[model samples]
Target: MLSNPRTVEKTALDEFISQYKAYIPKPALVKSEPVGGTLSEQIKRSVTVLDFVGQFVELSPAGRGLCPFHDDHRQSFSVNAEKNYWHCFAGCGGGSIIDFWMKWQDVDFGQAVKELARTLLKDRR
Candidate 1:
C-alpha cells in the first residue's frame, strides 16, 4: 500500500520559500569586509555536502567512491571538508550543495530554495 514519491508541489514550494525569506533577518546595507562572494561559497557555508547529499541518497562510507551521477564503482566523488565542495574525478561535474540538489531532484531554482529552507528549518528545530 505504498506509493511512489510525489513530485515537487509548486504551491508548497512557493509557500515555503515565502516563509523562509520572511524568517531570515535582513542584512544591513552597510559595507564592511568583502562585499561579495561566490554563490557556491554562500551555499557551502550554509550546509555541508555530506548532509546535503544524505537528503537525497543513502551513501555508505568506502575508501574512495564511485560517481553517483555515472555508472562506475571507483570512488571519485571527493568532498573537501575544508573547502565545503565536491568534485567528481570521473568528470561528472561539480558545484555547491544547492546545485547538487537541483540536479538530483530535477527541480527549479525556487523549488530548490523552498526545499532547502524546509530542510534547514527542520534540522534546527
Candidate 2:
C-alpha cells in the first residue's frame, strides 16, 4: 500500500523550503540541495545516530529502546553507534541518520537531509 512517495514528498519539501527559506543559512541550504550522494555522505558523517535520533526518542543504555515506528511493548529499536545506523527488529526498516529522520518525520529523502544539514550548519557556527 505504499503510495507514490515522490509527489507527496516533493510537495512537503517544497512547503518546507518555502516556509523556512528565509531562516536557513545560505551555506547550509547549499549543501543539502539536490540530495545527492556527496551531500548525503557529508551529512551522515557529520551526525551521530544516537545524538540525532535521541532528540526524538528516549534511548536507554546500549542504545536499546522501544521502537518509535511502531507500538511496541518491547525494546526492538537498536542504534548502532559504531555503524552510525539504526534498526527496528520488529520489522521497521533501518538506515543512516537521514533515513531514520525521514521515516519518523514522514518526509522525503531530500527534506530529511536538508533538516539534518540545517542542524549541522547551525552547530558549525
| Local distance difference test scores for all models | 0.65, 0.83
| Index of the highest-TM-score prediction | 2
lDDT of 2 by residue, 36-69 (tens): 4566787887869888888887899799888999
- Model 1 TM-score (2 dp): 0.53
Query: Which parts of model 2 are misplaced by more than 4 Å?
Result: 1-37, 123-125
lDDT (tens digit, per residue) of candidate 1 on 1-125? 11432665768767768988978989879755433344333445667877666555445553235667888776677666566666778887777787777777888777876776666545542
lDDT of 1: 0.65
RMSD after CA superposition, every candidate: 20.7, 18.9
RMSD of 1: 20.7
C-alpha TM-score for every candidate:
0.53, 0.65
Cα misplacement distance, residue 14 of candidate 2 (Å): 55
Predicted model with the maximum lDDT: 2
| Residue 91 displacement in candidate 2 (angstroms) | 0.7
